[model samples]
Target chain A: MDAAAETTPLLSVRDLRVSFALDEGLVRAVDGTSFDVMPGQVLGVVGESGCGKSVTMRAILQLVERPGRITSGEIRFRRDGEIVDLARLPPRGPVMRDIRGGEIALIPQEPMAAFSPVHTVGEQIIEAILLHGHRWGEKKLSRKDARDITVGLFRDVGISMPSQRVDAYSWQLSGGLRQRAMIAMALSCKPRLLIADEPTTAIDVTTQAQVLALLRDLQAKYNTAIIFITHDLGVIAQMASYVVVMYLGRVMEQGPVDEIFHTPKHPYTQALLRSIPSMTGTTRVALPVISGALPHPFNRPAGCPFHPRCPDVMERCSKAVPSLRPVTPTQLASCFLHHDQAEPS
Target chain B: MSDTAASPLLEVRGLQKFFPITKGFFQRVVGHVRAVDGVDFTVNEGETLGLVGESGCGKTTASRCILRAVDPTGGSINYRTRDGRTVDLATLSPAELRPLRAEIQMIFQDPFGSLNPRMTLLDNVGEPLLVNGMSNRNERTARVAELLRVVGLRPEFMHRFPHAFSGGQRQRIGIARALATNPRLVVADEPVSALDVSVQAQVLNLLLELQSRLKLTFLFVAHDLSVVRHISDRIAVMYVGQLVELAPTDAIFNRPLHPYTAALMRAVPPADPRVRITDGILGGEVPSPAAPPSGCYFHPRCRFAEERCRVEAPALREVTSGRFSRCHFAGELSL
Candidate 1:
């Protein structure tokens, strides 16, 4: 991103590490990860399950659940020309409460689980606005105002019959409608950053396409920075400007979308790009798979986490972990092949 | 796909499965949800026929009906038996269906739920061999070991429990269990969907290789078109409870005759960034099966829907050679 140097990043994560204490051992879910989300930039985090993509996003929100907590990192968010470290804020503290819904919002993976089944969709969204209504910049925000805003957001997210649909309970609506409602709830407070975690994974493909299009439209209209986390590379191709490929909690590669897809330096990234079946992929031919399976959390490999499954693994990979470094002018990768780069992350 | 044009291994016609909605103290049936309403399709020998649809479209129910997991309300499932016998599976009594069970087996979607958690891999895979008249433990063990190796798993792991394996390994074990009876037809329901992309590829390639190696015919039911396009010889696109289009994989992907099929094609995000989705013709949700709209079930969401489509239901008819479509203006629309 040429424009990256011109302006400050909206959110900067430096060596973020999240760990879960289990009976087996300490599971390093997010191990020494760093990245930047520029203002209005769509940063795509792509990885398979247990790859720590969700943990990294949760770390940013300071919403790491029980048994898991951010071990060490600096999550610097640029708010009103000042950088505030989110890692320092308590999860339930006042600053986090404001930032959770007021500045940074999340469109969670499962809309059915996120929503309260008993409450009507409109009532819940209105409740969010009333709780953080001060961010609306209006002195006296009424329930009626919140209702109107909720209805408008419903319409903005492309829900049919917004007036009547708002009164329907989450269960009364179909999967697609419920997902739109979730997106509406996330954008209710005009959040500067939206963290969408596999928002379209549950819905039908046609509905998924519509949701992706709606998100793109909303992001453009609000210029809200978004961190789209999904395992689908096709979705990343459609929605992201920059891409981050993660494996076993560490960033395997990060670069412009085109570079990451075309000239992936990390063997893991290269193998991943080849493994998926695309719309235009050859039929019946065996996809070159990344051999072996993801290691158990308790048995995370020494040195490079992906060394066990990497196609181009080296002896150095087993002894020392490679730091994220520039492989090309525009791309950075963590591998022995690219360790010769001068600067290191 | 051995002699795929010669004969069909299974044929389903007018398959209908309805669940009643009971209400009040008396539990009076108010309405019926037509889950698999008058669906028809055929699978030839050694061919993978991809039965695909979104949720609530009855793909899973139809697959279940074939396995007799759930009894069908009405249908004729003419399945060719191993001994040159043809039988209507839908009408067969449970006692009669027991023997035919060896001919047809299912691979479930959720790897964790399908396999018994308490059972060891030996018991899980060998249970099928044991029940299918292989009572000798030594014989079952040898066969189970070979089956495990067939699906690319370590034979030694057969002694281990299901919890010890990863998602991909568990699915392989599931495949081994399904193939233990040496079934001719395998109905796999979203087998690879639960695994990661890399692991999903491994499983998919395994399925393809096993099909060709074992000469096994597959009724691959899934919502993913890309995977379907990769493994299936023919693709059947279902909407609501009926098939909207059925054609060869290439034809369905390249020149779909139904608007819904084209809509589904357009919905799949091409991995290339240049082919971004900015606009779509599909709108509205898939209609509730119990309360489907008049005429075509997909008209509400289809961009090519016309006045006739709103009042008159379309019949599945041959539009091109070996291609069937259910649209009033099939093959007429540019879609």
Candidate 2:
């Protein structure tokens, strides 16, 4: 690693690829996707369903399941003055397990399914704390100490009556409270990086706003980096500093949040932004939508996956795949529109 | 859009639907959960009325009560039929209501669960027609093919089942089924909420086009403010089993009357990143319907709530020309 790379980013992924082995053929879930998450910054990954955003995050902590393998990539994570490649780590091994929850934690989409029904929410959080507390210098926390810590965590996430709520079962709590408990558990280890996969998608709008504010407050207090993954561009604009737009297993564009929203380079990104309904004006008009749907995974398109739906598609776009090249000083887009204007290496 | 000369297509007054909360093995009724309490609104001809609220706010209950899916406890649902006949749907008998069912149809939220797995798309969409005296199989097939074409789907693909289609396509199939009877008023409950953003736009556009072509009036129920604002001519904001505000879409977005409505408008995340939400963030959750707070249901969460709002419940009254609000200081407070 270079000196600048060593001191700058907390995690850097280069040319990452992940594929699922189906009965018919190989489904490239994530193909040649790369982005970096700096310390104390939230990186948002926005995409539609089946766009491989979730698969790429799953590949980061070595959590890819059976039939899905990280084919070739370099996920270099900086830890204690050492650079470790997470792509080659065995999923269930002891070292990877320690790094999975201790250094990198995940907050899943559905909180009801993530927590156990039989156990009280407090017990589950305590179990997580005990399992990973050693990394944070809490070697021997008794049951009482762990319970106290869990209560504190619940309070931190803006839950009312933390002591009473900690003992409540997952099914007893509402959707908003269940999500808050999930956030508390994810923060139990104080992981340097948190991967929140659509954490507020299932909740109400008011509750979503509250959760987003809470996340911003917690990130400022703990100084932890975040990888927020969602399909909502509105939430992305509110939460992330840097943004990455992904299509069918590929990075369509990546840049700062302001640039991606204000001056999008990729046709897919621009179209996606135009499709969202605006709240400022009360104009009863039809939204501008993309022409076609995402192609089937098994019957993937030849070159660019979005060429069929792209409004500014060229003849060459259907025949050749364009690599991610610089569109602006801070933005990069993988489109043939910028192929000729790109600066020479 | 507010045409005073033309009568309302459907008018609901003092609608109430309460489920008894029983206790112990004997199942004795102790109290009632007022799911739809005194909701009043009107859907004019060829206009969309958006009903919006958070979860557990009784929007679904009100829609279901209007359709008589669940028998309401008390209310008058006056629906004008195609032949210019007014009928009280809430008081109608089962046999008497069977014919009117074809005039008011419902489109459910989940396309996956709403469509039967074993049935083909043709049977699913054509079943309503078959039940309503269209017994000939060939005629039913022809009509089903035409309806599918209207929804932008291939007629040949009607032979395939719901499992062979995507979420958006299945939603289109649901729309086709809802439109099979040419209903005057269609009640759609979060129709496009389950689809992706790109597909949501497609479905919204389709709904807009169908409304114009078929001259259909809609009661579009959804939680998203932007989507509701885009399709609705007039919007009704609901809170704990009550209508807090009812006004034109532009009035509700620009000059809200109720505090709850103002907070709801502010809560929606703007599409532009530079627009920051400075104030009016709602706090706490909706109170339980069984034991809702006395006086105003939203006093606990409302920022401008005063002492009068805590002691006495406010009745929904007309505040301006075409706007109504349930707040005590509706016209006084510039929300």
Candidate 3:
């Protein structure tokens, strides 16, 4: 018999590579990325606009639109005492569809677009609950049970008068309420992993604070693992226990939150941290820029994509890509500067 | 020793813009959405006044009214022209306002949407110059090159379409167009909110440099307090279409007088893991402008609300020297 997969990560993405075939050339959106999401842990994916964090997330659920394919890699996930490779599952097949929204749910950046305009928010959530009812331990969710569950989720997300709000359309509610409704929908089937992609970008700061607080509380209560993808480092600091910094479709560094923020190893990580205009800085003191703009998607640089803007670039950095190596016990970085520590992959 | 205060470049008094809420097929007017309700402020010469507010809070509406992009329902926008001639822009006719348009310009938020797709950056930046009677194409091109160079973009890229440039580069082009006419007052509405953090710092630094170089007075409307703190000499806090607190940047950040201002400060996710938004996160959504709550519009969500706050509206009054607040107990609150 196989040994228990207890010590293994809840989700292990090993050398995951996703590429989009364009008319002009191939765009490697996620080039050789790897990370682990521990059970009930908050992992933040931070990067700039074209950094491919969103594509990586879409690939996890097999939702990356065609022309963009997961060319090579393994997405090993522990499910129901068995390990499954999500990368191999047919995107439109029953198994993948079941796992997409059933076990792993997604709250998109724009909740307004994610929801249907014709249906009431409550109806959509109820439909999700009814569809995934069988997966829930013992009882199947009936119509009445689904409605009650929808209302319960609403209340859990701190929507006032959940019973009345259950009938409201997505457009009728305020931006904050719409986001809360989206959260309720995502959590309807009790997903083990919640993927929030720039979830707080649309709302006001005050409402964003409320939502972040709510998400933290719910994560604690359900002990559900989360993958939060955003461009805001401030938000990452407040939310994640571990951080994955990406640049031009690759992971530059990964480590515990404190070490990542305090003492980043990769030059890209260091430059990104120094570039931000902090609240504590002397007013009007010009912040240091990363020197050059992001390379055009089609014209991505050879070897390390960040070598052009990297302050401590070596001659060999332009020749070949460096594999991620453990710089410290808990921290990992992909840079030629740390090549002496281990053999190049 | 104290230096003399700069003269007011523009003063807005009791600005109100009401959009009617229509219901039936006949478009029967139900009520009014007082988007910018009885607001007042002044932008001194060469000073950046940061107008801070959450969405639907009327900060955007108020800035638009000042620019006359959306005509206001009432109140006067007093402007001091170059020759020391004071004019009420609110009452100016189209012909009268045409020349003054060259004196004031705007920088928009979305860099992508603001620039024309078909037109090259040269024509896009030069359009304002053309409109203001810079008829000679050669002169316009020369001036556009100078403006582009001033904003830190390579002048050669002006011939290229906007799609060829990145978000940061596009925003610089937008700034160049806004400064084409040598406008004295620039109304930048959430200019850097659409940009990435690294790029935002670059833009902020450029704006700071340009402000001193050109002696430009700015009405910087933005939502981020930290960004506002970096750029503005004074900050105004708006809630439900009314100014709750207005003070120097340091005063508002260090010792906010109003509860709403204090709450807003707490909402900004501190970039350190040691700190988190634990308590006093404002509950409930912002009230709709169409049917705002009675008395103090913020009373329903305000943690410090009392019986009196629910019954009586508070007028924006000068609380101390160079400070203003609309809260009933502005001075007494420790926050």
CA RMSD of all predictions: 1.8, 2.3, 2.0
- The candidate, 1 or 2, that scores higher on lDDT is 1
Worst 10 residues of 2 chain B by lDDT: B1-10
Candidate whose lDDT is highest: 1
| Per-model TM values vs. the true structure | 0.98, 0.96, 0.97
Candidate 1: list runs displaced more than 4 Å. A1-6, A340-345
User: Native-contact recovery for every candidate?
Assistant: 0.74, 0.65, 0.68
Instruction: List the DockQ of the predictions in order.
Output: 0.79, 0.72, 0.73
| lDDT tens digits, residue span B147-266, model 3 | 999999988998899999988899999999999999999999999999987688789889999998998889999998888988888899999888988998877788888889999988
* lDDT per residue as tens, model 2, B1-335: 45532669999999999999999999999999999899999989989999999998999999998888899999899999999999999999999889988989999899999999899998999999998989999999999999999999999998999988888999999999999998988999999999999999999999999988998899999999999999999999999899999998988888999988988888777767798776677888889999999799999888888898898999999999889999999988877
Per-candidate iRMS values, in order, are 1.0, 1.2, 1.2
RMSD of 1: 1.8
- Give the lDDT of residue A74 in candidate 3: 95
CA displacement after TM-score superposition, residue A80 of candidate 1 (Å): 0.7
Runs in model 3 with CA error above 4 Å? A1-7, A340-345, B1-5
lDDT of 3 by residue, A78-172 (tens): 88888889999999999888888899999999988988989999999999888888866587668898899899999999999999999998988
Sort all candidates by lDDT, best to worst. 1, 2, 3
Could you give candidate 1's per-residue lDDT for residues A34-147 as a string of tens digits?
Answer: 999989999999999999999999999988997998989899998876789999998999989999988999999999999999999999999999999988886879999999
Superposed on the true chain A, the predicted chain A of model 1 yields a TM-score of 0.96
